[model samples]
Target: MSADCLFCKIVAGEIPADVVHETGATLAFRDIGPKAPVHVLVIPKAHHADVAALAVTDPALAGEVLAAAAEVARKEGLLAHGYRTIFNTGGYGGQEVFHVHAHVVGGAPLGPMLSPR
Candidate 1:
């Protein structure tokens, strides 16, 4: 784990988060800043720079992250209506934290996937 990474700290219990779900390999927590009625961040217990890196280095763990996100969405009651899972890669992708995480958001119409340019 990267000592300076915020998600790593959350995983390590050094920082507090509104955790929603957890598994041997993953953790799901509510997002501090909610863009939708339900917004949770699902992450792997192990650290990776980003989703792409995680996919390349440890595909199994990456799949675990997705599974956790799906579980979070189910727990959040978003399965029937629908939900969105996002992984912001780098700065251009809007990833603030370096640790790989999946944002599971739903509970209402989220509108367009991105702002119309």
Candidate 2:
């Protein structure tokens, strides 16, 4: 885990977060800035700068992240109704934190996936 990464800190227990789920390879937590009624961030335990980095470095771990995201959605009671999973890759993609994480959002109609640019 990178000492400077926020998600890494949370994984390492150096930081506190509203965690929702965890596995040997992944961690899921509530987003501090929630966009939906249910918003969770699912991440791999190992540090990855972004989705691309995670994919290239450890593809299986990347899959684990996705699986964890689904689990979060299910646990949040949005699975049967459906939900959206998002990965903002970089700054241009709207990624604020460097760590690779998936946003699990649902619990209500989310409207359009994105606003018109």
Model 1, residue 83: distance off in Å is: 0.5
Model 1 TM-score? 0.98
Index of the highest-lDDT prediction:
1
- Could you tally the backbone clashes for each prediction? 0, 0
**Tens digits of lDDT, candidate 2, 9-111:** 9999999999899999999999998998999999998888999999998999998898888788878899788899999998889999898989999999989
Q: Which ten residues in a row have the lowest lDDT in candidate 2?
A: 66-75
lDDT of 1 by residue, 3-115 (tens): 89999999999999998999999999999999999999999999999999999999999989988898898898999999999999999999999998999999999999999
Can you tell me which runs of candidate 2 are displaced by over 4 Å?
A: none
lDDT of each: 0.93, 0.91
- Total clashes, candidate 2? 0
TM-score of each: 0.98, 0.96
lDDT of 2 at 83: 92
Please report, as a residue range, the 10-residue window in candidate 1 with the lowest summed lDDT: 66-75
